[model samples]
Target: MSKPNIIQLSEFDITQKIIESLSNVCTRAVLFSVKNESKDATQIAEELKISLSTVYKTLSNLEDLALAEVDKFIISPEGKKIKQYRSRIGKVEITVDNLEPSLNLYPNTDNPKSSL
Candidate 1:
């Protein structure tokens, strides 16, 4: 029996999607603060120094786009609904520019190289 091979993801695949989803100021704020860890909207607002209303609205937008996910609700110390929000993917990818067009871009690179 042969084992299957695994592949890694590229920056281009997820960067644009994340950027587009996080275009809004509030959304971007939440994403930036929560870049390393999952956080609730209230916490995001506090971390970014924004209003709770704005954070909730922005998080809702992110949730709709599926770039960020809302976790199960839990009661916080303040007696408010707290739900963790984290990015759907681990990293953001962006395509490179001005390549020579003649490189083995992937594992299966049998395609003829492009001209300069």
Candidate 2:
């Protein structure tokens, strides 16, 4: 697979949608499962031992939140299209100061300068 072109976001860009998505256990698991490599919903469901429907729902949520994205599409022998999803953020750091929370996001790239 070729390197994914990920757009890095700054901490100031963090929003409630991102926080909510990251707070969900299922969503977090799905995000982590595809952090290192892109995978289809079926593979993620099998690896995470979750229902396919649930995986699809969580994937939709993640995509909507920009936490994860469709990295590429695979063409099966049957001429069907399959979407491979990958995590957009490599690392996420949440810090609480004076009862307020702050978020920092890192790009999901092989570049050491970009990695957390």
TM-score of each: 0.53, 0.80
In candidate 2, stretches whose alpha carbon ends up further than 4 angstroms from where it belongs are 1-14, 111-116
Q: What TM-score does candidate 2 get on C-alpha atoms?
A: 0.80
lDDT of 2 at 97: 86
- Give a tens-digit lDDT track for model 2, residues 1-116: 44323333334454555776789899999988988888999999999999999999999987766677888899989999999998877888877889777777787783223333
The stretch of ten residues in a row with the least summed lDDT in candidate 1 is 107-116
Scored by TM-score, the top model is 2
lDDT of each: 0.54, 0.78
**Cα lDDT of model 1 by residue, 28-83, tens digit:** 66755654566887788788889999888877766554445654578878998878
Q: How close is candidate 1 to the true structure, as a TM-score?
A: 0.53
In terms of lDDT, the best-performing candidate is 2
Error of 1 at 35 (Å): 3.1
